[model samples]
Target chain A: MSNNEHVKVPANLMRRFADDPEQADLEVFGRRSDGDRRGFLRGAGLATMGAMLGAAIPFNRNMPAGFVPEALAQKAMTVDGKDGLTVLNDRPVNAETPPHLLDDDVTPTARHFIRNNGIPPENTSADGWSLTVDGLVNNPMTLSIADLKSKFEVVTERLVVECGGNGRAFFDPPAKGNQWSLGAVACSEWTGVRYSDVLKAAGVKDNVIYTAHVGADSHLSGKDGKLAISRGVPIEKAMNPHNLIAFAMNGKELHPMNGAPLRLVVPGWPGSCSQKWLKRVWLRDVVHDGPKMTGKAYRVPKYPVEAGQKVPKGDFEIIQAMPVKSLITTPQTGIKMSGRSMKVGGHAWAGDGKVSKVDVSIDFGATWQSADLSDPANPYAWQRFGAGITFPMAGYYEVWARATDSEGRSQPFGIAWNPKGYLNNSMHRISVYVS
Target chain B: MMQRLLPHLFVLVLLGAILLAPGRPAWADEDELGGIPRAPGAEETYYLCSACHSFRLVAQQGLSYESWKETLVWMIEEQDMSTPEPEERELITKYLAKFYGRDRLARKLAKQQ
Candidate 1:
């Protein structure tokens, strides 16, 4: 039995290199020029082999000014190897947890996807870190972690926070940003105070319609130089019962990678709204036009686009609640099996709605069977689904999971081709061999 | 057939070009390149973009010349990235469009299909 295994390189790199010489040129090895050569030798068969041997050389150990360090790339690959997380970028640390590894109802903090717009500040401690609530409020106050725990009723709830472009690789004509597979999402129990309670203490002004969130993570260049991605959610979303200013994840102090000290947990919205290492929450009269809010950052086309079509002018809308999506974490694709029957299970989530039903297909969507879905622990948490499958006679099979929300919206077979590849809730398929 | 062999043959031609080029170093490493195109003025282009984020992030997106121009404009306007003067912007645009542009991506995609 043969199964396509996930290689560490970008999804298209190996295939593209195999297809054309020009494709090889576009890859890491092909970008070399004579004048700027390093101290690593390679054979001519390197391109044909499609294995990046030169990538092993650690020449950027002490990268010069204005160059990204090689250590971050190495760490990105090694940091969460158990989850089979795929690295998309290193500086500012962006990686995706493979769908197969995200099988549990509550994702382990280590398995959660790491999507950072700026580098985590060195030596961030609860000592110096405090959250400031200001703008359109009668009382502006900066509160420490102790203030948050003492002043407000601390609550713990499970929630799903996913990148808007979770399954971007499925997009045809392929979009910009990280080419994330179905691993850019996770469900976790977040512990903190309700954001509304904090705002209430500050006395919300009537005209306030949005909350601009800012974090301590600074740019690799400099803070005074460029803004490190200040984004916001509408006042309505911020006022949701589940929205939190979380200080802990999975019952432990938040992992520095997950967001230490405090992070906003905006359940059922794009993870960007949940600013990690959060420090400031500014109430605003209008939508926050921060770095990512403008010019097609988290925005997508208002209507379905034909593949390869340029985005129409003024049709781009800011993505709010993500669409219904599911992933099969068990029986990871390409795992060879000897059993007649196997326990198949995974996790599913719907933004601003419940995952009403989840269906599993063993014959590549030819036939479908209902997977028993566990109830969501909270209104915003992802639900776990499981089903027993007995293969009559199987050489190779791909298990596909599709989810439908209570609103009757279901995951599409193919993602609508948006330019930025936002909201890719296509069916999550995993292949395995049953012998 | 030559169709099958053409890509392999093209690699050989590229190798020969590297071997024959002036001031060519004896070796090259992937870490040094970081996927940046080693075309003329790439250093200027790399540092210019690195002022905001990693060059690898920019290199990953294969865009059309127009899209690349628009990206620079987007960086300058939306991202608060410092704007380069007219002549410098032209040079950087040429370098980006030449290597990371749509034609190269389309060529690769056509072959893959």
Candidate 2:
């Protein structure tokens, strides 16, 4: 896993589908023949190819230029890694931790999914890091990591930080951006100061409508280095007791990739609201129209749009609480079952409130069996569930998990497609083969 | 390592296909600029789109001609991406539609699903 090690790309990108990575004929793929490739390449000139290759000539991060980080690369090479997660992009590195890898009560930092809008800051040292609280406040203040630890109560809570577009790949037409499967979600124990306590210290004004969270990471657009992804939530959500200005994860300092030094942990909302490498929290009068807040970045249809229907500009609604979602982690997709029965378990969470119940459908939603839902450690922590099922025959089967929130909201069978492909909390399905 | 080599190898395989079998382009946009497949105006499209992020990000999405045009307008007004010349826009738009169009995207999605 060292930088100097020679990394070999596995010929196969899929896990359960292709059991033999070594024998996967990546060149021919499954259906595309040699002639099809030749015609496509003939249309695509080598001059262009040569030019792109030239840009990558000086791969000097002490590693390959276009390659993923050493850790991610190593993880993807192993059989377990292939089944555990998929890397969507490498530069601003985006990767999803397979639902099976996230079966644990607390998601390990290494297994946490990464969703970065900008390049991570190189200076991760906490020695000089400070967080400034300004805008719509009576008294603005700046606090360091040590000050945050000593000044305010530090509490630990297990919660899920899910991307808004977690299950986008399953969209019929397929949405834009990372065609993420069911891996863009994970739960972790975060230790930090209560954001409400910080807001009290800052002496927020009554007129404040929103609180903007800013980070130090620079935009990858190459336009301006100072351009960072600064987004915010409503004042009510910002002042919630559960939100945190986290400095540590699982009793350790935050990983650089996970926004080291400090980050906003706004549970139940889109992960983008929890800005990593957090530098500022600016209270605003109107909705904070920062980088991602404008346009249709995080907004979906106000009302459901039929699949493939175009949404008008004003018909969009900003995403707030995520929908009810659950994933079956144990027995993973593609598990070869030697016995007729197997134990299945996973986690579920509701954005607006706590999970009320979870149902497992082994017969592809024909019938459902209620899984025992565990009491949450905290209000926002994901609730764990387990169920045992016996197969009638040896064949292929899909285990679908559906979660319902306290508000009686259950996950939809299929997601309504939007341009940005946000908030896809459809029933999670895992395919298994019984021998 | 293998993660990095995987995309390069896939692109190379697609490149290799140029000889006997010229099939549909494989999913090639998941890395930095280097991973973009070669096509008409491929260089122009990659450089222009990549000024903001990797071409792979752009290549991942499937947008219609009108939606792509709207995306350009939004980029200019919101994301600070520069607008290309009229002629340049036509080329880039055509290139985008050809490589990352709805048809191409359907193939990629169908294969993965």
List TM-score per model, in order: 0.79, 0.81
Fnat of candidate 2 is 0.22
Scored against the true structure, residue A426 in model 2 reaches a CA lDDT of 84
- Model 2: residues with Cα > 4 Å off, grouped in runs: A1-84, B1-35, B105-113
Q: Residues B1-113, candidate 2, lDDT per residue (tens digit)?
A: 99989989876765454333323332333123344444566677777776666554674566677667777777777667778889888877877776567765334533343
Candidate 1 CAPRI grade: incorrect
TM-score: model 2 vs. ground truth = 0.81
As a whole number from 0 to 100, the lDDT of residue A117 in candidate 2 is 87
- Candidate 1 per-residue lDDT over residues B1-113, each given as its tens digit: 99999978877776664454333233333333444545775867877887667665665566766777888897776566788988889888888878766555533443221
Highest DockQ scorer: 2
